[model samples]
Target: MNINGDYHVHTAFCPHGSNDKIEAYIEQAITKGLTELSFTEHAPLPKSFSDPTPDKDSAMKWADLDQYIQTIEKVKKDYQSQLKINLGFELDYIEGYESAITSFLNDYGSVIDDSILSVHMLKTNMDDYVCVDFSVEEFARIIQLFGSVEAVYDRYYQTLEKAIVADLGPYKPNRIGHLTLIHKYQRKYAVDQGYQFTIERLLDIMKKNKLELDVNTAGLYKEECLELYPPQAIVDLASQKGIPLKPGSDSHTAKTIARGFNKLSLLTNN
Candidate 1:
């Protein structure tokens, strides 16, 4: 047995979730006979929607996250016989969002065992979009000015570079979530073929900084990649550097947990 561990599990603390109470999920994992259970709730963000003029509501759901942690602590004792539970959070990054990322991270980082840096929507104009690192108006303005297909790619890749390189913390990351899944949306060029332009730099950056990425297999569930990010070449390079590895399904639902991890493991082990 692989000692089945699920580290990317989320809970109702995120706006995108419901009924994901850590205790309930932990119990479910025990039912499934899981060996190790971890809860990595979404990282906290600032209140952009509470500007009063535009009461769009916050991008993420509101909850007593600290209390949620305390609740997990309370429940852990009950599940001690079935599974070992750990705590973590999935952090998002934007250039300006650094302060919020840093603030919340500093407050909570020490308390948790690990954190992951995931760049969600690539900051769009929609205030509701998790990708609010940059203004959507700016993305449109560039499109209108340049009007070249390559220009859009240039901007997107540049933005991604910033996100990947952003100053995170004392620990680089336990595992990287969907590395290039962003291409499923905005990528103009074939990600694998054209990724060199992006990877050539990011590879060196991750290597120099000693960062390792994940082999996220959830893409099989979403029908995106044959698997998820960092492509084969990147995986090879990371292996060469002796960078660490973490296999994840990025499971949102209990059913999606480690869904395609078997095939994903074979691909990355090369």
Candidate 2:
């Protein structure tokens, strides 16, 4: 896995991630042997988000975002010799909330390099959705109830199907994040046959629709379900289907960038 780009990254702006400056992430990526990297901080639908978000006071502080962007632009100019740093964000899914995302994106839509739409939650009121991190407790509950890889796959992909229908269009995503991360804490919960078959069907759908995916390494950070999104079988199917793939860390913290890449290589080798 010659991982070239760290497309999924977060900084202080995301509230939950490291408080390090944007330049810190760029430097770390360069040291990790990245050729390209995009800074995709959490861009939540302000109104849809909780007033006091888990990590910050509000969804996304526009002030911090502007400063972060400015820092990235300046550092890109200053370093000039490092990776091709880009500005993008993990735009949370809001059903009718596309307008909010679209409006913000419109400013940079012309020149911005990339964007990733992630459905952090399954259900929402109205069309508006905000990126909400699954609490460890909630994740544990989900796993306890639906962690069987088969159950996890069923729900996650179904949600993904809805997302593809509602969110993805015109601007096709550069890559899908943590395709099978719902199983991260519950590999034992995932059964073999049903999970595999269902994911195969989803890969077929993505292939038919011509979507690219990132082979995420974030699962390794967890104690279980150490494979990338949609699992290895899905990845193989996607490969067979001619979907382009790029390795992504889904790095929420600065230290773990590019961690556990070997696990992905093992899957690829087999």
Clashes of each: 4, 14
**CA-lDDT, candidates in order:** 0.58, 0.62
TM-score of 1: 0.74
Writing each residue's lDDT as its tens digit, candidate 2 over 134-190 gives 555555444455534355446566777655555444554555666666666565444
| Residue 264, candidate 2: alpha-carbon lDDT | 62
Question: How close to the true structure is residue 37 of candidate 1, measured as C-alpha lDDT?
Answer: 71
lDDT for 45 in candidate 2 is 58
Candidate 1, pairs of clashing residues? 123-131, 123-132, 123-133, 125-136
Give lDDT: candidate 1, residue 156.
Answer: 52
